[model samples]
Target: MSYTFAIIGRPNVGKSTLFNRLVGQKLALVDDTPGVTRDRREGEARLGDLRFTIIDTAGLDEGPKGSLTARMQQQTETAIELADALFFVIDARAGLTPNDRAFADFARRANKPVILLANKSEGKQGEIGAMESYALGLGDPVMISAEHGEGMGELYDAVRELLPEPPEEDEEPEALGELTDEEIAKRPIRVAIVGRPNAGKSTTINHLLGEERLLTSPEAGTTRDSIAVEVVYRGRRFKIFDTAGLRRRSRIEEKLEKLSVADALRAVRFAEVVVLMLDSQTKFEEQDLRIADLIEREGRALVIAVNKWDLVDRQPGQIGALRTEADHWLPQVKGVPIVAMSGLMGEGIERLMKAIEEAYAIWNRRIPTAALNRWFEQAVQTNPPPAVSGRRLKLNYITQTKARPPSFVVFCSRADAVPESYLRYLINSLRSGFDLPGTPVRITLREKANPFAHKRKRPS
Candidate 1:
C-alpha cells in the first residue's frame, strides 16, 4: 500500500503550496485568501524517490464551536485516522499563533507519528518564526519553502523516516490502462450528479470527464435515461451516474418522465457522492432543496455546484451571502461545500472534483464498532425511541449493513410498530454524531423475536 501523509495547519500557512509542490501539479486551489479550501483535497504525490497519497486539509482555527472552521477540524481529524502518518504544518513567516498551538495539541492527542513543518522558511525573515515553532514539541520542525520548491529533499527524508512505503512486492501496482476488476471492487466509489431539469447536470459531467459521454441538450428533461459513465481520476476509478432532471409528479405527467424520475432515485440509492447542481440565476429553488433533501434521505454524499457562474454580475457579498444562506436554511447538511463555476467556461472545475472526492470519502465511511456503540448509547440517552402501545420500542443494537449509500439495520423488539418519525430522528442523530452531512443515511428496524412469547417447538 502507498503511504498516506496528511498536511494540516492553520489558514494561509502555505499548506496548499506544499501540496502543489509535492503533487507536481496545481491540484489544490491556492490563493492568498485564508480558508479557500473548506473540504479535504487529495492527490497522488511524489517527492524524490518516494511515492505516497497526499491529503490537503482546510486550515484550522480556534473559534466558536460548530463554525465552518471547527467542522473542517473534524475533517482533518478523520483524515489522520485514515493516514499512515502526518505532516503537521505551521507558518514560519506568521510565526506560531494560538490556533497553531491548539491544532498541535490535537495532533499530539492522536499519538500518531508526525513530522512538523515550518513553511515559508525561504528568506532570512522566517528564521525567528522557525525558532518559535520549536514550541510545537511534537519534534524538530523541518524548515522548507513550499512555494520555491526548496527543501523537498529534506521533506522526503523526514517522511521516509517514520513510515516507509510498503515494499514493491507487497505494494499493489497501479493499473496499467483500464482498471482491473480487483481494483474496481477494492474501491467501488459511486458518484451521482443530480439537479432540477436543465441545471447543467449533463454538462458538468462532460466537463469532468473531458468528453461528451452523456447527451447534453437545452430542453428540460431531455435526458430521460439516467446515464452511467466511468472515468479514472488521479488513479482512482470513479463510476459516475448522470441522472435525469427530477420534477414533481404533477409536473412530470408523462409516463416516460415518471420512469426517468424513478431512475434518478435509483441512481441516488447506489451512489457514494451525489453532486446537486443549481442554475446560477435560480439558485436554491424549492426543487433544488427537495433534491438535496432526497440525497440526504438516501445517505449518499452531497455537493452543491452553482452552474453558469460566469454570466452572473460580480458582487463582493455574493459568495459569503450564498454560503450563509445555505448554512441558515440547510442546517441538516452542515459543512457542505458549495462551489461557483461555469460548466461551460470550466472555471473552478478542478475544485469541484476535489470536493466530490472528499464527500465520497465521508459517505463510504464505516465507523469502528466501539465508537459507533458509544455514539449509539449517547443518542439513546438524548432521545430514547418512542413507545408503542405504552411499551417502549426495544432497540437492542445497530450495525452497518452496507456502504455506498451507507445502510444500517437496528435490531428491535417491535420493528413493525416503529414510527417513521422515530426512525427519522435516529437517522438524523446518526448523521450528526458521525459527521456525515449532505449524505443520505438508511436505517432499517428489525424485530428481535422473543422465544418465550412463541409456542413450544412442534413435534416433527
Candidate 2:
C-alpha cells in the first residue's frame, strides 16, 4: 500500500488550498466560506520524486449529532484513521484558536505522525503566530503559504521522513510490466452520473454500489463536489462519478454552488460515458434538457436514466412515450438509450448497466475506410447537394477521422458554401446509415485543393 497523508485543520485555515496545491488540481472545492468540503476526498499527490496518496478532509469542528457539521467531522475522523501521517494546519494570520487547540489534542490521541503547518506564513506579519504554534507540541511548524506555492520543499522533506522506503525492483515485476489489451479491457469504465438538483443521482449510485457510499438527503444539492467511487457489478468494473446537481445559471446565487456546478462540469469532460439521471416524478424539466445537451456537446456517450421509476404511474405504452419524447426533445442525440429505473428500490439496474455498456461500445466504435466510403456514396447519391449561385456544389469524398463520437471530414468543392442545413442532413444520415445512435456525430467540410490550377493558363 502507498503512504497516506491526511490534511486536517479547522475551518478556513487553507487545508483545502494546501490539498489542491499538493494534488496539482482543484479536486477539492475551496472558498472563503467555511465547511465547503463535507466529505474526505482522496487524490494522488506528488512532491519532487516522491508520490503518495493524499486525503483532504473537512475542517475538524464540534457539532450536535446528525448535524451537517458533525457529519463532516466524522468524515475527517475517518480520514485520520486511514492515514499513516497527518498535516495539522493552522491559520497564521488569525493565529491558533480554542478549536485548533482542541483538534490538536484530537490528533494527538490518534497517535500518528503529525506535522504542524502554519499556513499563510508568507512575511513578518505571521512570525508571531508561527511561534505560537510551537505550544501545540506536534513538532517544528513548517511555515508556508499554500496559495503562493511556498515552502513545498520543506513540506516534502517532512513527509518523506514519515513515509516508508519504496519497494525494491525484485519485489514486484508485474507492476513494472506494461498492461496487455485484456488487462486494459478489464480496467474500470469511467462514468459520470449528472442531473439537476435532487434527481436521485447519489441514490442511483448507492444502489449500484450495493451500499450507501455517498451521503443522500431529500435536500437539494447535498453533494457539493463531484465524488468518484469504484464499483463492480456482475464482474464488470466501473469508476462512477456522482456529481453535484446542476441548476440554471441565473438561479445559482451562492459562490459555493457556482463552484460546485463548475466541478460537476469538469467531471463530465473527463468521463468516457455520462448518465443524465432524471427524476421521473418531474421528468423532462428544462434543466434536465440543458444537462443532456451539455453531455452531447462534450462528445461523451450518453445514457438517459429516468430515476424513481417505481413512483411513476405506469400506463400502457408509457415507456414508448418517454422514448419518443427523448428523441423529440433532444434531436441532437437521436435514438439515445433511455432506461427507466427506481434508484430507491434498485429496480431496472441491470437495464441501466446494459445501456451504459452499449453506449460505451458505440462511443468507441470505429468504421472501416472502405465501408464508410461505400455508405458515403450511397448517401450522396440518395440526396445530392443543392445548387449554390446556379452552380452545382460538388462533394468529392468523405472519410472518418476519429470516434468516441464519430467525427468525419467531407472533402468538397466549396466548403464555405455548404449550409448548416445540409451539414445537419449529412450528420443525421451518418447516424442512421452507420447504425450510430445517440452518439454525437461530427462532420467537417473541407475544400479540396485545385491541383490542375497551376497547369492551366490565366485568362488575361
Candidate 3:
C-alpha cells in the first residue's frame, strides 16, 4: 500500500515547482503563465523516510458552474477525496488573496488535514508576507522557496505528523478476506491509453473525462509526459492515464523524446487495463502489434481502441474482419477487447469505456482455491503431464495465488519440462472455464508440490 499527498493552490503560485521539488524532477510542466497546468499530475515522491505517491493538482480558480474552470475544480475535489492529506501552498509574497481564501474554505470544508505552505519565503521581505498565512486557518505555515531550495526538512516533518503510515507492499488479502460480490462492484477501474505518436490518446482521454485535462494539438506528438485523471462512471471511480506516444526507440534521436517514451512504458506497468489507441485509417500497423506485445509481456489487461473511426470509410464487413484478423494474429493477447471510437466526435467511445471496465473486472478476478484445484484436477485428468526424458512428471495441485492479471502456480514434479505451448493450453483453459476475458493470465510450474498443505516427516 502507498500513502499519497496532494499539493494544491491557485494558479501561478508554484504548486508545480513544489511538486517538481518533492518528486526530484520536472515531471510537471512549469510556466509562469496561469493555468499552464490544466490537469493533475502524479509522481513517485520521496520526502525523507516517506516513500509515497504525490499528486500535483491543477491550480484552482473560482468560476461559474459547468464552466471549464468549474470542471478543473471538480478535478481538484477528486484529488482531495483520494489523498490521505493535503498540502495547500500559498504564495508568501502575494499573501491571503480572495482566491487563496476560497480554495482554503473548500479544503477546510472537506475535513482533511492540511499543511499550509507559504512558498517563496526565502528572503526577509518574504518573511513579512509569510506571517499573513495565519488568516487561512490551515495551521502554522511551513515556509519554503521552491526555486531557491529551502525548508524541505520542515515540510517532511509536517507530512510525517499529518499522514497515516504507508500501506505495506505485498498482495495479502485483508483480515476480513474473501470480499463479497458487492465489494468487487466498488473497486475503481484503472485504465491506461497507449499508442504511437498522435494516435489520439489525449483526445480519447478528454472524451472519457468529459473535459480537456490533457493538452491536445494537431502536432504529431504533443503529449511528452504521462498525465493521470480520475472520473466517476456509474458511481465507481476510474483512474485513467493519458500517456506520451511511443516512437521506435532506435529511431528516436532527441533527448526529450527518450524520456517521454520511457514515461509511457511506466504508465503501462502501473495500469491494470491498457487501451491501445490506433488511428482507424492506419489499422494493424506493425508498430501497433509491437506496442500490444509490450502489454502482453507486462501481463496487463488490454483493450484495442481504433480511434478516428468517424473519419474512416466504413464498409459493413471491414471492422469485423479486422477484429477477427487481430484475434488470429495476436494469440498471446487472446480475447482482447476491440472498440472503434471517434475521439473527436465522442462516438463509439462508450463502448471503449465499457470494454475497459470489463477488462479491469476480469483482471482483478480472484478464483477461489477449491474451485481452482477442482479445475486443475479436471485439466490434468483430460490431458496429463507428458514424459520428459522417459520420466512421467508427477503434477500434484494448482492454486491461483493472485489476480490483477490472474497468476497461478502449478505444483509439479518437473517444472522445466513443461513446454510453453502446454502452459498456454492451461492458461487458455483457466480463461475459458473461469470466464475471465481480456486480461493476461500467468501460470508458473514449480517442482515442489503444495508446500503449504503438509509438513515434512523425517524417516519414522
- Please report the candidate that would top lDDT against the real structure: 2
- So what's the TM-score on candidate 2? 0.93
Measured by TM-score, how close is model 3 to the native structure?
0.67
Q: Which ten residues in a row have the lowest lDDT in candidate 2?
A: 167-176
Q: How many steric clashes between backbone atoms does each model show? A: 4, 0, 0
lDDT (CA) per prediction: 0.78, 0.89, 0.82
Of 2 and 3, which scores higher on lDDT?
2
Ranking by lDDT: 2, 3, 1
**Deviation in Å, model 2, residue 153 alpha carbon:** 2.2
All-Cα superposition RMSD per candidate: 21.5, 3.0, 8.7
Tens-digit lDDT track for model 3 on 1-460? 6788888899989998889888898777666667756557778787766778888877888688876677667778788888888889999997779989888998898788899999999787779778998988888999999887799999888887765665344454554257776775666666789998889988877877786667676777667667877888767788888887887768898766676687778889988789998888787788898999999889899999888888887778876786787788677877788898899899987788788888887887888999988998998889887788898878889888887778999988779988887898898888889997657888888888465667667797
Candidate topping TM-score: 2
Query: For model 2, how does the per-residue alpha-carbon lDDT over 338-412 read when each residue is reduced to its tens digit?
Result: 999999999999999999989998897889989888988888899898989999999988888887778999999
Which 10-residue window of candidate 3 scores lowest in summed lDDT? 167-176
